[model samples]
Target: MFHVLGALVFTLVGVRDATWTTDGMAAALLVAGSIGVAGNVAYGFDSVHVALGDTSLVDQAGAAVLIKPLGLFFPLTMLLCAVAVRHVAPRWAAVVIGLSALAFPVANIGNIPALGVAVGVATVVGFGALAMRPVRSPSPATPAASAAG
Candidate 1:
């Protein structure tokens, strides 16, 4: 996930260097990366808590009233990544951003660990493509616009 966020930052920087001069998009990328890193760390802690079978955080209502806030940030961070990527690289962006968007639902719905892995992989590859330099070649004219013949 962090790798995905990092790729997003690279994409934003690449697009800005090529198209516009706005720092807002670049800043957004950094912010999203920071948030994603933090959220994933928190999620790791939460998973540990669950593994330990420590349900003390939740009440009899079967609600994790305490950990809910921390968990919420993870999805929100992912959403930020999606929005930023979509705005910067709309082309081929869906391959990554779409998978990321489905990560949360897929994780919770089917409880499939592979879904999250796939999303991360897609993000890295998609954004990596965005960072590639455009292919260019000199005009097929002679020396001097064909030597101004």
Candidate 2:
């Protein structure tokens, strides 16, 4: 559920940024973030029930050692970004919700597959949305004739 929610946030942010900003780079970031969300979801779908040390995709010799560390650092990064972008678009909502998703993964350090998915979705969605906002257009001026009359 958290993973799904994170993906939703990411998509919404991407769509918002693509629509509002002229910066191609921001749009690209959103795209990358979206991909991240998709990847996380796929990972969850493939292996959500395997118990630890029972042999699964991540059971490859050094894989667990390498990947588990990511869980530790990744959440910190996400939390930093969330804090750093509080003044930005999507603001606190994205930050808070995203942090919520990170709770499980950070706590379990990626040991819990389901938690990993949750954090992945939440981070992308929250960060992606925060980076983009709708552009506002100025109102047209009233006619001179109307004002003079």
TM-score of each: 0.47, 0.39
Give the C-alpha miss distance for residue 104 in model 1, angstroms: 2.5
| Backbone atom clashes (below 3 Å) for every candidate | 2, 1
Candidate 2 Cα misplacement greater than 4 A, ranges: 1-13, 17-25, 48-55, 60-90, 97-105, 108-149
Best by lDDT: 1
| Residue 26 in model 1: lDDT | 45
**What is the clash count of model 1?**
2
User: What 10-residue stretch in candidate 1 is worst by lDDT?
Assistant: 135-144
**What's the C-alpha lDDT at position 138 in model 1?**
20
lDDT per residue for candidate 2 within 8-62, as digits (tens), equals: 5655544543443334534454555555556544344335435343445345565
